[model samples]
Target: MANTSNKVREFQRKLYLRSKQEPDQAFYSLYDKICRFDILWDAFYLCKANKGAAGVDGVRFEDLNSIETSGKLIKTLRAELVEGRYRPLPVKRVQIPKDNGKTRNLGIPSIRDRIVQMACTLVLSPVFEPHFHCNSYGYRPKRSAQDAVICINGYLKQGYQQVYDADLSKFFDTIPHSRLLDKVRSKVTDRAVLRLIKLFLKAPISEPTAKGKSRIVGNPIGTPQGGVISPLLANIYLNDFCRKIATKTPCKIISYADDFVILSKTPFNSAQQDWIKNELEQEGLKLNEDKTHIVDMTQVGNEFDFLGFTFKYIVGFIQHTNYVKIYPSKKSQKKYKDKLRSIVKHRTSLTLDQLVERVNRVVRGWKNYFGKVGYPRQVFFKMDWFLVARFYRWSRSRSQRRSLYLAQDAWNKLHKAGLVYLQPTKMKTAKVSR
Candidate 1:
């Protein structure tokens, strides 16, 4: 069983690297492998339980079938794992020898607060169109590569139009650690907190590893290049920057993470841009110019991506297809069910009727705000589709009465988007309201 798991990990890594190169083809291949693996793993588990082989039971032989059925085994295996009852694995702690008799533990929040105060802020530009892609999980759109282009064009539009863009020297390492620490100490007047900050400065360690090699660990300092908290932290810092700028001049700051677009109505001026750049320099962050651009109105494209939603030149021209859809898979229905099961497992006490109330709550909000925007079918997104389908199934699966609120919000949202028409679903306990 361990060996089988190891092989699965190996395949996942190789596939991950390959997918980075050829995402489209690899997505299909990886998706198929995951599906097939799930089916076989389930079969093997049932067979082993019947055979009384409580342990390994030579699951590797079945796993070897991973590449079979056009790698259907691998696909099934991953899906099962994602949906399986895997317990949280224990983490290994590393011991680092102290230089003297004292060691300090710097709490990230303490240091982060200080970073925000001392660091200069940057007001990024607003997202316009074609700059971001959709993420179904977060239920938000993300910036696309072209969005970067629009960012530069936005700057140019305001008259900081420069023909050249440049990169910073030692962008990441140049952050002034000593100054940052000092700033942190000033913000939090606790001695113990200061001690922690002091220790963190001297003992910056690589991120904690959970399992497996080749995992990219984050460098300390609360900046997760791609983690959830990173954006919030960056936003805090940038907000301070914008406040400072707004104090001295007029500029609006808008951002989705590090990517920024600043609007200055003060005419096309390099001085403001320069001052903005200088402020960022004080804190260690720098803009990459090789990727930056400056374009006039003619150069401005009609669409861009910002804040996860695609912006088109025309009002109400958001392309929902790029933002929401069930992922490509043969067992869409089953996968969707598994998701709902997990949701219910976590929320053990929620009754079907209560769930109905909750979903309807969100639906009510949708109706009040976006009710008249588009057709009911267009309103519901992939998230709505999956959630609604799951709740409907759950209501039927359980003999006890279940509520229907869970599906209500998603359904109404989907309906407003013109994706589906109004349909009444019969719940166990009561008649679910649309």
Candidate 2:
């Protein structure tokens, strides 16, 4: 099983290198690669492993349980692709609330569609991954948000004393379909593959109504955020932007999907910033002027936040020597703490065991993510402190008003319930570098 799992997808690797070498050449008949049984087989497992909710079609992973059943489904999809009979279903539309009191729209594709998308992305990623700029780090294999943060740090330490934060307004929703399709056509000339992709691109939406019925509506632009291929498609759409900023711009640029931050030796004034905005607009992208700005890092006490980490300078205690400091941004910390608070405060009706289990899951995941960079140990200490107080209050609320030893009793009760929290430390913080 281990060997089977570890086996390389050789066709993908070879094609990856081939596309890397000849990025401009459009090769026809590449659709057959995605239709390979092995590729679909791997994609089936990937889709199963993800275990997401059923899409607009209501076909769940459990519906395709065994090897034979899963194989049949894959073979059916392969046949549909080979014979040019595949039809994409309109994705299920869902809305998620944002931190800024707005809701972000997501489209959930069917399970079978997800498998196809996965298979396509697995084969297609190799073809496009090599051409993507090093600075573009979202949704790519191996690279991560930490790598993007590391990039900014590298540029900052190398005397890039200015920061330009570029916010693309409604980036995913505003992508020009014709332009994106043209970009894809430049290299991916296979009619079948292109057709399948276009089918997805033009997929309408199945939006659920208040009466539990769903309505089908046209989606004229943008990829659905929740679909498996959305991120890859987003990267493809902005591939030019990545190449342009990384090559043409004088400033150092690091991006995660639509979030671009420019590091420069000289600060960009309003005129230069507007010029940059015009250039991006020419590429069919627009900036959110409200959230976009530049910061001159050479000046004392100037800093910026990127990818949940704050890039600023610290004054050393012994010699007053100054150096760059990277830590979990305050916004990130507050959001994490609020999540923790919500779990305990709202769920106090549950048993201590149940509440602690829920809380522990969040605490562990948060620590693992924020612990990647910076001295967040102090931050961890504060979180644990905050948790203790919240738990103590929760414990107090559960007890009798007649209890004489409230503090000690609550402490003892919390200990007995086996609640988990971070252990504060002064040791060296874990760091990730590219």
Candidate 3:
């Protein structure tokens, strides 16, 4: 462990220093570095440790959990790469239900391919991290949604009047492979690395054909959402985009991958919006017209939603002073409330203690995601109240229930039953250096 960890750190340090010293300097040799036994092992553990479904190849983590089997697999993978016989297979396609009654498409890579991707990312990430947008907080190391929210909160406090809510339609699916490779070539001149990336980019999709027969079809142009390297690749593709906005626009932008909103004192006019649209189209992307809008903060009743939270100016009746506050959007709240109701309803067969345990698990997860937002006290309290009401009402109606518990009694009973209750918390402003 010590030897492997030290090698990984040293390799990353070298890549960072070299890339930093000569930003545009291209290297023709990186394949060997990426394929090193130590680096591949490090990358292997990275994939094995994280939970994911098997790819189209149907290989799961349990199949390769043993150190002996995993080591042999890595060796075989390295040999294939060295012999130039490596080819990534078509990705498995799956859809997940979104909150808006839609589905999000995810493509799963084979376990072997995932290891190679992780290996490549482990070597290339340090070289590329220095060049990505500082304010872009999605999917990067040491950045989180909380950091992005804090940035927006600070900007609003500084009196940014208008929020330009921008949404890229099918961002990941529409990125032009040619353009992305060109961007990659600007700094990464390694032929082997480029070839591997191109193969990954054009990897076909295994999808249902006629009569639902599964077959590999269509050369996908964008990064697969489930690939280990997709986030970094996406950031690399969008780095130039951030620069363009800085150079050409009057607004300051903060982006979390595809979801980005620009803050400015003045609203973007028709011409400016058209320019942005044209810029996106030239890159094989388009703006989502339905989701794009300019939020005027100066207006009394106007609010705009960004990154799952709705930002609005609230005026107190006593002091009559306006201040900026944000909370989970109404859509998000409703979805969560429905989720809680469904959980309690679906766990009808479980004992009270078992049901409470399941609910607490979800409550903790929900709190982790939404609890840190600005001015979430009232929202958190309301959510707790809603959960309590739903659970107790359902409990009292149960035929096997012992006693009819009052509201306060129900709270105490649930507490005694090990139910985890969410408490109101003030949002902490996190500072990130540019």
Question: 1-434, model 3: which lDDT tens digit per residue?
Answer: 11237879888889888988888887778989888898888888888777689998888989997999998999999998999999998998877787668887788999999989989988888888788877888887778887898898888778777888888877887788989999888888899999999988899998766687788887657888888988888888888878788777767778898888888877778888888788778778888898898888878778988767878787857686887778888987887888888878734787778888888988897788778778777788878777766775677567465454444555567768987767743322222111
Off by over 4 Å in 3: 1-6, 209-212, 317-320, 400-413, 424-434
- Between candidates 1 and 2, the one scoring higher on TM-score is 2
Q: Give the per-residue lDDT digits (tens) of candidate 2, residues 369-430.
A: 77787667777887877787666567657755533333555555566776666764332222
Q: Which ten residues in a row have the lowest lDDT in candidate 3?
A: 425-434
Worst 10 residues of 2 by lDDT: 425-434
lDDT for each candidate structure: 0.37, 0.79, 0.81
Residue-pair clashes per prediction, in order, are 65, 0, 0
lDDT of 1 by residue, 206-258 (tens): 33445633222323443323222233234334444545654676554444445
Q: After superposition, how far is residue 239 of candidate 3 from its true place, in Å?
A: 1.1
Flag the better candidate by TM-score, 1 or 3. Answer: 3
The most accurate candidate by TM-score is 3
The superposed Cα distance between candidate 1 and the true structure at residue 289, in angstroms, equals: 3.7
Ranking by lDDT: 3, 2, 1
Q: 1 or 3, which is superior by lDDT?
A: 3
